[model samples]
Target: MQFGIFSVSDITRDPVSGVTPTEAERIDAIVRIARKADEVGMDVFAIGEHHNPPFFSSSPTTLLANIAAQTERLILTTATTLITTNDPVRIAEEYAMLQHLSQGRMDLMIGRGNTAPVYPWFGQDIRQGLPLALENYNLLHRLWREDVVDWEGQFRTPLQGFTSVPRPLDDVPPFVWHGSIRTPEIAEQAAFYGNGFFANHIFWPTSHSLRLIDFYRQRFEHYGHGTKKQAVVGLGGQAYIAKRSQDAYKEFRPYFDEAPVYGHGPSLEDFSTMTPLSVGSPQEVIDKTLTFHDSFGDYQRQLFLMDHAGLPLKTVLEQLDLLGEEVIPVLRKELDARRDPESAPAPTHRGLTEAKYGDRPVRRPRPNANRGDNVTGASPYQDSDAEATYPSLT
Candidate 1:
């Protein structure tokens, strides 16, 4: 049960203050927010990807790398890395580099992002989003595990003896979580790969998320990774907290009413009842969050969206203080007590490295000399298995 915050990186006018932050201000604010999360002992900090306006996180890896340099223990990750639009080769290369740079203190979530027009901007078809997500991740999976890959697919050019440089830290790839709001195929994909499944549990009802999570758990066992209980699961939520429940409601109501994501629709009370959004005192937040475990069963990671809907930086920081000081300690104790002993633990880089290497020395890949870094040479790594061979174009 890891607790942390994720920002969608929206640069919008504060509904109450009527002041829209400049892009520069929003970017600076995000760094400060992540630092506050770390200071408060949160376990993970994640950011969302959006290529359009009202959102500023067009380059997640760059931002995360900066945060990783400053923070010691906080796990940095993405809420959604566009698997449909971004090339799998680039995804493999960039994230592997991030893994090494972060010292294995990171993981990532991939999804067919919600924005549709972004497809053409990236030279992809929105109608084929599902297939693109499926095919692209298939390649990314191999790119991480295999040192040299020979592959072809519908969405990209063929690869002959391609090796993404800067191989994963300790020879272990970052753990992946497939993020989806309603796609069963995505859930199925995650289960098939024995990867983590993350439900963006904010907009929809808990029952909706439960159905998808239940389906994922079922298929995860079908693939023989482990028991259904052992499936890695993560969820998204949002909260706005104050010392008193009335103060919370009073402060957050205006922002909620005008929020672009779910605004101009349901009332605050109605939306909160129908969705995972929490607005109240620390104890009230804890009470609502516990219901999530009660409905979805024991899970691994829980991330909250706190910086969106035009919340001011100072207010967001205060929210983090309350959450860290009042909400998390109690939730950690309660969830741990209620957890099934047989269920899986939260994903971490150190845990994955140890699982791969145990008592043995971890492999650090050192590329062999070649003609200007060509992959046509023999096994790239000096320590590669002797029998492994990569085909040459010559």
Candidate 2:
């Protein structure tokens, strides 16, 4: 299992300090946070996308690309890449650029985000969110895999001989994980493509997430990717830790009560009991996290929400220290011991490239001299189909 942290990128006032971090402060703090995760041996660092206030991460690729330049081993990804709203062409182009810049140290998790108003901001409709997600991803998947795409879709203008440039690093597209909270269609989509399914397991009970995961596993195997145990899965969670259990609760309670996500609703204790929110000592956190495997079975990735609800950067860094030093080490050992031998490993760039190419030379596309337009060159229909259409591989 891979363990790491993801931020929703909320810039809220600290309940204890009664001061909100400036956008500049929050942005800088996030970079520091990501660096600290890498320093502490965490495996991944992800940031969410939100186009509205109380959140700062509208452009996740730019932020992730910056972090990619700064960190060595940590895999940078998005907690939620809005597949419904963003143009699939742009996603294919931008993320492919990021893949090149990071040297394949990145992947993306796509979801129809929770915010409703984000639809019209990008000239989409919430009612069509499901189909939008499905259609857009269909196009994106083709964009990355095919050298020249001739396509038309319900949501976007038709494409004729379009190529998403900077072709995926090493001719292998970045791995994709379809993230969903309650939608089974998304799970079905992930399973159909043999892609990873990520359940945002933060808000709901373990049993609820279990149903979605189990369905995904069954469908994944039904689609003949592999056995259920071999299906790729990921779960989200939240945690806060202190030397003592009481100290953990006392420090985190105020923020929990004020948090816009779950605040002014369930008591922190009830929330923790019902969901995957763990607020306790290191041992307590480890104990709670172990139960996730018990409930969800063998999974690949585990990401926690630690920087939201106005937690100060200093405090958040302290939590990461505890997580890296005290919590994850133990969890890694225990989970490794318990994991099914037949289960899949966490997705990685090298793994995908190797899976695609094996010992053969990797393909490097070299386009013909510019023909002033893409329709006549490097397109599948070039020269009335008398010759090969794809760019010649060097």
Candidate 3:
């Protein structure tokens, strides 16, 4: 299993102090949080892509590339690479280049972003989001795999023998995870291609996430990918932890109450009881997170929303330290021991390649016996055989 932190890059008021961070501060903080994640042994660090106000993460690749240059082993990823609006060709080229630059430490998740206004900003209709996602992803897949592609689609012009430059390093494309909060169509799409499904389960309750995951798992098997348990699954969570449960509540309550995502909605206690968000001690977070596996089975990746809601860099870094030191190790051990081998493991470039191409036998060139010259000869098998002959019995 892979453990990591994801930031939405929300720049909200401090609630208590009524202070809002500048755009520079938020961007710098995001970098700082990513570095802290690497320093504390987190497996991955993902940044969300948003274009509207109160959110700073507009270009995930730039941020992830910066993090990639600094970190050695941390997997750099995107929480949401917009599938509906952004050009698939750009995604294919940029990420492939980033993969080479990062030495294969990058992956991305695709989604139709939550904001409706972003559609027009990118010359897309919000009503066509699903179709856009499907068509764009199909093109993106082909751009990564085929050297040259001829394609026609509803949203974009036809491509005639188009080849995306800078082909993926070693023919390995960044692994994709389809992220959806409530859309079953996205889940079906992910399963259709045997890609990872990430239920951003931070907002909704466990039952809602369970149903979405169950739908995806069933569709995954229906598409003949594998059994339900073998379906690729990733989940999202949120947490605020302290040594004592009381301190956790006292510290996180103000932020929770003022958070733009969930603020003025459910009470903290009510939200925690209903959703995957944990506001308690380290042990409480462990226990709550364990319950997810119990309900959802052994998932591939678990990412927490740790640095959102304008929490200062110092507090976020402290949270990372606690998460690294107190929570992730125990969860890793337990989840690994309980995982099934037949199930698809965490989505990685190497794992995807092995699953797709590892079993094929290597073809060796056969030498020509008739060659009198002392030169290496090509095999007869190099060309298709029209027929086989048998020697005469005479």
Q: Judging by TM-score against the true structure, name the best candidate.
A: 1
**Candidate 3 C-alpha lDDT tens digits along 1-394:** 8999998888988876778999999888888889889998888999888898888888888888999999977899988899888999899988988887897798989998867889999999999999999999999999887665779999988986566756776666778899997888888899898788999988888888889899999999999989998898999999999999999999999999888878888999999999999989999999999999999998999999998776878899999999988999999988888888887777776676676568874222232344344322222222313232333459
lDDT of each: 0.92, 0.91, 0.85
- Tell me how far candidate 2 lies from the true structure as C-alpha RMSD in angstroms: 3.3
TM-score, cand. 2 vs. native: 0.96
Better of 1 and 3 by lDDT: 1
Distance from true location, Cα of 128 in model 1, Å: 0.1
The regions of model 3 sitting more than 4 angstroms off are 356-394
Instruction: Identify the runs in model 2 with alpha carbons over 4 angstroms from their true place.
Output: 374-376, 379-394
Candidate order, TM-score descending: 1, 2, 3
Rank candidates by lDDT, best first. Answer: 1, 2, 3
Q: Is candidate 2 or candidate 3 better by lDDT?
A: 2
On lDDT, the leading prediction is 1
State how far residue 53 of model 1 sits from its true place (Å): 1.2
C-alpha positional error of residue 179 in candidate 3 after TM-score superposition, expressed in Å: 0.9
Cα RMSD, each candidate: 1.6, 3.3, 8.1
Task: Tell me how far the alpha carbon of residue 365 in candidate 2 is from the true structure, in angstroms, after superposition.
Answer: 1.8
Q: What TM-score does structure 1 among the candidates reach?
A: 0.97
